[model samples]
Target: MATSNRPNAPELDSACVAAYDHAVRQGVFDDSDVAEQLALGEAEVLRIRTVLTDLRLLIRGEDGSATVPASPEIAEAELSAHLEAGIIERREQLARIHRQMRSLAPVYRAHRHLPQASQSVRLVEDPAAVRRELAAATRACTSEAFTVQPGGGRSPEALNEAIARDTTMLKRGVTMRILYQHTVRANLATRTYTRKVTELGAEVRTAEEIYERLIIFDRSLAFVPQERVGGRPPGAAIVTDETIVGHLWRMHDKMWQSASPYDPRDVDYASTSEEIKASILRLMATGLKDDVIARKLGMATRTCRRYMAGIMDELGATSRFQAGVRATSLGMVKPDPNP
Candidate 1:
């Protein structure tokens, strides 16, 4: 009988030899019975017989009974050979991978020197400097741009500058997208700004919790605030690495997908209020106080309490605890629309 040429065939043959040895020692089965038990057809059984014969572990008698030979050296040698071949093949594969990595070392080293390198991130300290850097990044962009501004709270001057740049880019057919927090709909200035950008064909969406401002140009360069925009440092910037930029872009997309359309002056604050109410109800159900809920929702504590009062009125509750129970009973906090 011939052996298979498959990669694992030798190892498989060795295992078959071990099983044959066990069956022979058990003395409860003939070779044909062993073949049936092992689920191998006659051809495979013959191959095993040949291996066992080479090992001298089995002797064929004229009466058609099979007897075990004295030695186990042959089986041990077959197993060793199979294992050695597998190890050699694995080592060769690893060597190939190492050689490929070695060939890429120079390119990797060069990339580390580029502005996008991870370790040498620069900080832009002045607003003018930050704007200059962003403008430079815009000029360098060869692909699409993405941005996120939570609270839609850009300064009037900055907003005007961004609108002008976005308008110019839109006329030139560059792709741009921006995301804002749902609160933007209620901010007249932000609504007007978004309307102008939307007229130029840029995409805009809104979410409830937009944490930081992010701008990614061509999926390559990104700018994020190092200090909160209103923080005491005045103006501080952190130029992003490729990995962080990519992550920001992904997060922007996820929020954008969940945001409602930015309809400027036409936005319904009533719906926004309802969303706030629902969020308050969720927090209340968790036993959170108005102050804590206010911070989490990025609103004033008084405003949060006012919203809770409104929720109670809507649910016909006489107290805060009653409002929570009623909200749950009516399932008012069920999954909301993407916005």
Candidate 2:
């Protein structure tokens, strides 16, 4: 028979191997009676024969009754040779992938540090360009990254994408700080996203209010939103100048100092809703309508009205003005020159 290339060939039964060992000690073996001696089927006998041949354990013999003894040294050498070949093959494949990746590194770096990107502040209006710049900066970031997601909630897909990106950064030992609006406490997707990042040693906090979206890579550069006015599409400002980065970092530090910790276990919707209603009460006392308050808090008007109705009912007030007075009496709303 001929040798085979399989590294994990069909297993030989223990009793059959013992029988082979006995035969090897006798310096010869009769393979024809192997099934009868081992109480195995013809298929099992054939499998053992094939594995022995592939391992170079069975020496040559034309007739089954004249088979030669096993050779352990030759079998070990053959297996070692096969393992060596597999290792070499894997190393070569990795080398090829590394070369391909290296080819793209220069291009990515060139775009990441373009002349326009080198400017004090770049006004990038295209969404695709904004994403490209962000991806480039994130890839280049070494020590740390910080982000502020001001809107209340994120889509499940967006949360998954963030988890994948931030997980890689965390694995590379990058420190991350993320700030969210207190409204995120009511958002399942946002909570899931923050919980995952927090588990990776990223600091997460929530505030009643946070500035517009910001992403800072290390202490070198920052990205902040360029408002969408009229009918123009929204964009971001890529700030590379040191002076601007310092200004932005200081603003972030101040907010982080004031933001509350995002405790994943605190999924108390009722308490969060009451707090939101109290905020609405204060805002309503200031004469902001339902729509304005809803817009200010990044929630729907109907939902805001529901909270307001609950507040009004609790105060036993028939009108907004009465509700304001009753809330003030209940210490839910304090009078202020700003309010």
Candidate 3:
């Protein structure tokens, strides 16, 4: 391969990234190792080989075995150079998009001024409005209700309130399913409520990370958070659109099947934290921001950050990404079977 640094070199694809990351850790890996480790096909391996070679990350051997390796430090420097070139190109595109947004601002404003009844979506601001919307949706649920509640644990008052609503819904023959983080398994109040609902015909499960807070009613109505306007109070959306509501319901259905069944004995379970750690490792490996991970685990941002610091310290990592990479190489976590 030419040693020239060419501007036209292709950007690294996901396979190439995996191979590169593997190489950085293992120092070298032959064709079979790369294929087996990354689960890549022949064509993908070929592409990854070409990209790694062009980036000066791997040196081909005459026998197609025992390729010479590049030090990770040097490879990372080269990676930075390649990324800088790509960023320069993308920045121009972003600037043009921003200009277009400026041009369309007035049109957006005009639509915003339209009467609320005209839109199929209902935007509820303020805590009371959100609660009312949710209550109304739950009451109207005829067949099933699925909810993803991402947060550590509910307060006694909050759990009582939720139990009252959920118990009624369950008794009315509405099948209730809720998704929670493993952390909630340790919360006494939450577990108590979880047990009560499960006995009342509600199915509860937990996952490592949840996407967002949502409630889907009878596969017809769905409620989701609305992005808050600048300095405005937080709010949510009551989605009535068939396409959107169906999508949300399907999402909940998939996550429901993936999550572990809520076990009563799991209260004070040490393995639950391990599961949460594995999820954090997986999410960290993919470069999710801390706040995003916190929301998924239903934990406070501060708590999440502290937990990561502890993990990184234990791993002797110099940075968060390095901690993630080390954890990945160690197989500290397996991919969630359903996700």
Model 3 lDDT tens row, 1-339: 223455666687777778888876786757788899888888878878887787777875567667756765787787687677767777887898989987997886467533563345767667677888788777878998988887788789878878889999999999888888788888889989998899888888888767688888888888788665675646887778899889888867787887888876555677777777777778788788999988777888897888898889988998989998899889885775545
* Candidate 1 lDDT by residue in tens digits, 1-339: 233354432333665666566666775335677676777778877777666665546655557655554345765676568667767877888899989987997886566453533343656567777777677677666668888876435667668887877777777777888887665566666777888877877888777666677888787677776655565434444555777767877877877887777667575588877776777788888788878777666667887788888778888999888887888888876543333
Each candidate structure's TM-score, on Cα atoms with residue i matched to residue i, is 0.57, 0.74, 0.57
Could you report the Cα RMSD, in angstroms, for every candidate shown? 19.7, 5.3, 26.8
- Point out the higher-scoring one by TM-score: 2 or 3: 2
Stretches off by above 4 angstroms in model 1 are 1-120, 229-237, 265-267, 289-292, 295-302, 335-339
Stretches > 4 Å off in candidate 2: 1-30, 52-140, 225-235, 325-331, 334-339
Clashes of each: 0, 0, 2
Arrange candidates by lDDT, descending. 3, 2, 1
Whole-model lDDT per candidate: 0.70, 0.78, 0.79
When summed lDDT is taken over every stretch of 10 residues in candidate 1, the lowest stretch is 1-10
What TM-score does candidate 2 get on C-alpha atoms?
0.74
Best by lDDT: 3
Minimal lDDT window, size 10, model 2: 1-10
lDDT of 2 by residue, 1-339 (tens): 224456574466686586577667767655656666667777877777776676667777666556676577777887788777777887888898989999998886566554555556877878778878777787788998989887678779778867888888998899999888778888888888778888889998876656478888998899988886876647888888998898888888788887778777677777667667777888888888889888666677988898888888888999898998888878888444222
